[model samples]
Target: MNTLLLHCRPGFEGEVCAEISEQAALIGVAGYAKGKPASAYAEFVCTEPGGGERLMRELRFERLIFPRQWARGEFVALPESDRIGVLLQHLAELPVFGSLWLEVFDTNDGKELSNFCKKFEGPLRKALTKAGRLVEDAGKPRLLLTFRSGREVFVGMAETGNQALWPMGIPRLKFPREAPSRSTLKLEEAWHQFIPREQWETRLSGDMTGVDLGASPGGWTYQLVRRGMLVTAVDNGPMAESLMDTGLVTHLMVDGFVWKPRQPVDWMVCDIVEKPARNAALLDDWIGGGHCREAVVNLKLPMKQRYAEVKRLLQRLEDGFAERRIKVSIACKQLYHDREEVTCHLRRLDR
Candidate 1:
């Protein structure tokens, strides 16, 4: 039971594997990752027994850029009959868990297995309860049962606070029809991922002013208006009529790259389609020049070496802040709603 199973977005298994392999080596845990690209999952098999626990203890899931969720456990192939007995027998070898989650991969084939998982969950939970392998204590690790098929399953465990907030790290955010475009979900998901919900009241309020670059059609602007914010929307393209009616927006028919706010605003968000390096530089200028207190920018990634490019850009951002003697905090993620790009959240913590 020394294998670590990780769930990731389809087409990014290689990036996830590379990241885990590098982290494993850095933490003194020798391991190898196995997974096919576009399979939507990866398995990191440790060299020694109990190495999975060591790796999990040493690594923080939040630091991982690619994997949405990871669990440490053993892989098992169930028998054709008496699947319950086989599962219980295998589960008996591990410690009792606080909760249990039956999951499938994030792929099309995985979606086909959902019905089976749902049908199997009740009986399995009852059996585990009867066998004293499940409990309600938050201190205990969560038992993750990921099914590859009817005959195959992976038994893994993760600490409560150490894993993603939702299954497969995908937040269940609903899109409001009031927003002009579905692209609004990208910014919404970014906020959920980057900003702690509890801090929204103070950091994101109607009193604060903001600017949205490339605000055409008003997807991101809708979010700001809903929060009761006054926003200067910069874009030559047209914005949604509904957003303008809110009386919360000021449209500027100009280029986002050349435009600058008349005064330092509380927030600056960009969703322009541009090279990631250029966007990184733009964000640096915004923070360094004191044009905005915080920003959420999207960087369009190149087709190959996406992870490597993000690493380099992030390092450059850190250096840019350092060179200007600016105190800032930055977080970047390949969001669930984002494709071919990664979103960056930056905030100035000091004057």
Candidate 2:
């Protein structure tokens, strides 16, 4: 009962395992991570009795780069018959939970178990409720039961305040066909993750202006214009004519790295494919120079050390911002639409 289950993108199991091992060692909780490539999940078994819970407490979810979601629990092997009884017995031994989410890995094999989970939820909830193990109060912990197969399951728990908002840490996002490029979904997901929905109307209103560097074909630019903002799409390559027809876009042909906005704009966005360090430094300059109030930049990662690179870049941004006495909010994520790269959103609070 001292194993931690972590869900991550398929093919990133190695990164997840490495990150967990390093993070666990850093916190003085000796542990070993093990998972096969493309498993879409990994596990860390601690050497100490209570080390599992301690690892969870020490590692912040926001700071973890590879794992989308995590939970501390033990593996429960189920008998072929009386599976429900076995599960109910385990639930009885654990504390009452506010919510229960039955999930599987984000892989093809995992998707095959989705129907089972959906059908199992009803009877499981009924059983838990009958035994008084289910509580609807939001203050209680969230129980996560991840099934690798019908015969095996991992029972874990996470504090509601610290856990991910969705099951398996994936948000349901639909792409708009009207957008010129599929890259539009990256920016859309960025806003959902970085900016609170309640503040959208006030913070992303029509009166605001934005500059989209590397705006060829107008993927990220579409989001700004859709929100009814006047946008200057900066790129040497031609933009989509449909985007220009909106009568709110000004396309400028120039190098995105060297070009500077004539005046301070409400927002700045860049999706240039370059080194992560360069992108991080560019963001620091953008916010530090007060070129734009906010910005979203993408960093294309290399073959190895992806998590380490992200950590270093974030620290660099923090150090630069502190040196300039700039008050800002910065968030980075590997979006569902993003591959081999991460999106960073930076907002400067000072006028």
TM-score of each: 0.96, 0.92
Q: Among these predicted structures, which one has the highest TM-score?
A: 1
Q: Which stretches of candidate 1 lie over 4 Å from their true place?
A: none
Pick by lDDT: which candidate is best?
Answer: 1
Clashing residue pairs in candidate 1 are 206-228
Displacement of residue 334 (Cα, Å) in model 1 is 1.4
179-209, model 1: which lDDT tens digit per residue?
Answer: 9999999999988888889999988988999
Model 2, span 162-181: residue lDDT tens: 76667898878777888899
lDDT of each: 0.89, 0.86
